[model samples]
Target: MKPRSTLVRILAMATAAGALAWAVTAGNQPSHAATGPVADAGPGYAVEDYGYPNADKILAEKGILLKCGDGYIVLADCASEQNLLRFLARDRADVCFKVTGEKGYLALELESVHGVRTSDVSTTHLEMTAENDRVTYDIPAKTWEGVGESADGREHTLVEIRTTK
Candidate 1:
């Protein structure tokens, strides 16, 4: 009986010592989680300016200054498709845009614009600058309207276009 009791106490002490050693070793080891601010170099933060994408390249190649927009309206080829909003200018080739979504807006600069053709899906509102005064023209859906220099006798530069369904 005494020998059996002594063996039980020895086994219990060994287990307690093994557990304590394991706990101490684990407590001394460093963890992988971040405990403070790190000074390591990483990828830069992304910032969106929203001015216009590829604006400099487009202006240099095509002589068109597309400043900004909501990305719903985009420039398109005149002969690309039907139902496109088209613009006519005396000094340059015909400029056209494709309108999508429920509404669209674009700010640009086109010189000597004389006419505007609205698409069949939405009404068009155009703003132009003649001398120092601002001129606005509203064209209904699926219609051809005289604007800018053709409407008045002065040369006008198209500045903005807004459309709604």
Candidate 2:
């Protein structure tokens, strides 16, 4: 009877040890199912494309096609603020932009832009294309300068505006 009891106790202990070893091995293995802090980590990372916000609305309403920008230079209401960078177009009304930071850049399409009035904050560079020819103008700060067709007799389209302090 003593030998039988001892054998039973040893069998129970061996079974318990096997179960614990199995549990530890299974726990150490990587799980396909998502759980715990890794699963609860919320959303993924965000990538910025630097596209102009509300560009479709502005294009539809104001006939100005704003493409991309560095976020420092933004479209603005001409009447909303003073010292805005203003543009003079052939058929369209004056378009304005607000400049911030040490440098700013904007790529857009405004047709027949003949002149530009740069703000007092920074010097502005205008890039335009006329009849397969690309032209660039460097305008001093706080000055109104002739650009595109205003400089040449041919019609020109404003393509980009870059500013630096």
Give the top-scoring candidate (TM-score). Answer: 2
Per-residue lDDT tens digits for candidate 2, residues 1-165, read 699999999999999999999999999988867566754677766899988999999899988899998988898889998889999999878999999878999999999998899999899988999989999999999998888887887999889889999
RMSD of 2: 6.7
Cα error of candidate 1 at position 50, Å: 2.9
Model 1: residues >4 Å from true position, as ranges?
A: 1-42
Give stretches of model 2 more than 4 Å off.
1-44
lDDT of 2: 0.90
TM-scores, in order shown?
A: 0.74, 0.76
Q: lDDT tens string, model 1, 1-165? A: 699999999999999999999999999987857354454545677876655678899899878899988887888899999989999899689899999868998999988999988999999989999999999988899999899888888999999989999
